[model samples]
Target: MKDEKIVGSFQLMKSLNKSLILNTIRTHGSISRSDIAKETKLTPPTVTNIVNELLEEGLVKEWQTGSSSGGRKPILLKINSSNFYVFGIDISPREIRFAITDLNAQTLLYKTITMKEEMTSSRLFQMIAKQLYIMMDEACIELKKFVGIGIGIHGRIDADEGSSGFAPQLQHRNVPLKKELEKEFRLPVKIENDVRAMAIGENWFGSGVGISNLVCIKISHGVGAGFILNKKLFHGTNGLAGEIGHMFIESSGLKCSCGNDGCLEALVGSEGIKQRTLNKISLGYKTKLIERTNGMIENVNGQLIYEAALEGDLLAKDILEETGRYLGIAIMNIIHLFNPERIIIGGGLAKAKNFILTPIQEVVEQRALTEQAKKTEIVLSKLGDQATVIGAVALVLNEMFSVQYESVS
Candidate 1:
């Protein structure tokens, strides 16, 4: 009976504390103890207890007193913005994206370091560490003030073991990334698939804000999808849910690096698109893309193709449309299977929204089931390239809040 009583009281405390903290400022805006009690249905004593704890934890701050209501003025309480920061990194093949963010995940500083030449997992990790150190130093932020560190990678992840289970791009499998980073910096580290991180971040701060069911498809050097189902990041069994890139979109077509043929990535990835376009133009294809690119057909990406289309380059425009149509085919399948409420397009290639989105939208509008299609809204990701890094930070915050609950309750 004694143990049960203690457990019941602890459970009550958890529910009440979370509600009071979230509701206090929510109802009254900038509220004080007296107002919080009046608005929350919580006793003045209980409100007082929780507010004091929040103040000490730097979660809330007391501002100046409000105007007198012909009685003793109440002290104003506001959410503290600078209490702690979540550091995030997106370790992409082309670049290293990093950000310093406050408690609410608002970025304070953003920086990118390029990987001009070769990229090895070990070397890239060190580069990331170096860039993070520089970012912290430049921002004059002490390591202690950082809530946590999060790194988003492109490929499968073993979330439980905190390792990169198998990343063809990174050429590392089951690498103990989180543990090694945590040991090096003395900070808790979270590692996740880049698309998964983006989905979480988008749900928290971008296109999926307030939406529970959505998909964020990133089209870059590679293509990937991140899903949010039942208001949570859904990584299926064995952490291999969002490998949309490797799925067979072409039965016996272009070979993918994953020992597969006709993966969606092979048909639309930057390298693939560039190779195909360069080959066509070099063979005397008549398109404004060549002249715009100064006739240099070394390597073209979706962005360049989009630029040409926007500039009325006929071949470039057609290429983008074709890719978008293929995307439509793949995304149509995604819609049919998962039936998401929203489809958010993002990535380096999404910058070519003018060229890619319209064709994809057209196909979806034409082919999808009328009822499901009507329910789903397709749009561009507001965070764009920053989505990956911001999502990484969201991973850290999720871990931080969960740990806080563990400690408090």
Candidate 2:
């Protein structure tokens, strides 16, 4: 039950034939050995060998018999989803969330730690390690049961290095997340941008399931996007492919954290929405928001505006509608550029979907080039607040199920 022994056993399961057979069983829910061999194009003996190894390792199990073609029924195999576990971490500007999930990405234990203030990289690392230890002890799961650790963090990420290039909210640079965590836990570690992780998570377990090309937009204190192109997470050169928040939308609009004017995030991100509401208030346009925030303009925020809009407050509704229009413009541009099958919106602002979704649809309808493009699906995230954290878990599951070595013909 030593950590190395566990790691070694997991590593042994990474053979190309093993991954192919395992994924086949996972995908089919339960599949016969002959069917797996046919589906994976592996020889019957190869499939039998790997499946037997998987069963012995407890990664998969033989289920009830499947219908046969006149002969005896064949025993089917399926993933032993609960046999191994993964750790997922979601790091945002204001908080860090931790989750333990089975192989299916179903959360088992979850916890959150709020940040009163920003801390150094070392401090952040210590907090994460301590909390993970507490969670492991609390869950009482054996150390050998853990397969890997995954982290989804904001800002630029050097995934190959498993380090953060710059976490703007945390004000930390070059934080060695993968290196530190793998050293501390003696388990494999994966890291990705928070938004990209959400996209992957959605593709695997949420709304984007079965969609080949998709985009997931997170609109909170800041805006960001994750892109899935051709059924794969597309990380552009320098891993900045989905930084749509900084995408230029207007030259004369408000400033963004990236120190740019009129970026998509500046127009519709939570701060931008709040600032626009405050600007409207400053212009002598009156509404219940003044009293709702107790005449303290600084207390005004996206959620309060949404609540006010729900109550038929014209000013609040108008602000959200305009914000939606801004988001729609950005999404339309995304459609023109990537032409994804669907775009999923998540985060704090998505709660105002009632108000914003209409405007967004309207803008796309009015401006998109082709009729098909105009009808592109735009929906809110099914995973909601847990999207990023679940995506963190997907980072590990993805690795676990993927065929690492290319198969020889």
Judged by TM-score, which candidate is best? 2
- Please give me the total number of clashing residue pairs in predicted model 2: 0
Per-residue accuracy of model 1 over 1-409 as CA lDDT, tens digit each: 1223222111232454544554457434587777777776778888888877767766678888657878766678886758778789987756778999986788899998887864545576677778788888989988777767888877743344355434442324315566456666767677778888898888777888878688999988788898887667777765667778877776645787666888888878887677668767778889876666775767556766877787788888877887888788888889998889898999887888858888888888888887667447888999998999999998876554432211110
lDDT measured at residue 136 in model 1 versus the true structure, 0 to 100: 89
lDDT value, residue 260 of candidate 2? 80
Supply the TM-score for candidate 2.
Answer: 0.92
lDDT of 2 by residue, 1-409 (tens): 1335336346877776787788788778999889998888989998888888998899999887646688777789989999889999998867999999999998899998999876557777889989989998998887678888888887743344345433442223424766677778878877877888899899889989889899999999778898888777887765667778888887756998667899888888878888888888999998999999888978999889989999999999999999898899899999999999999999888888769999999999999999999999999999888899999998887877784211111
Error of 1 at 195 (Å): 1.0
Candidate 1 achieves a global lDDT of 0.73
Candidate 1 clash pair list:
none
* Candidate 1: stretches off by over 4 Å: 1-47, 63-77, 116-122, 156-175, 279-284, 402-409
Residue 155, candidate 2: Cα error in Å is: 1.1
TM-score of each: 0.81, 0.92
Best by lDDT: 2
User: How does each model score on lDDT?
Assistant: 0.73, 0.83
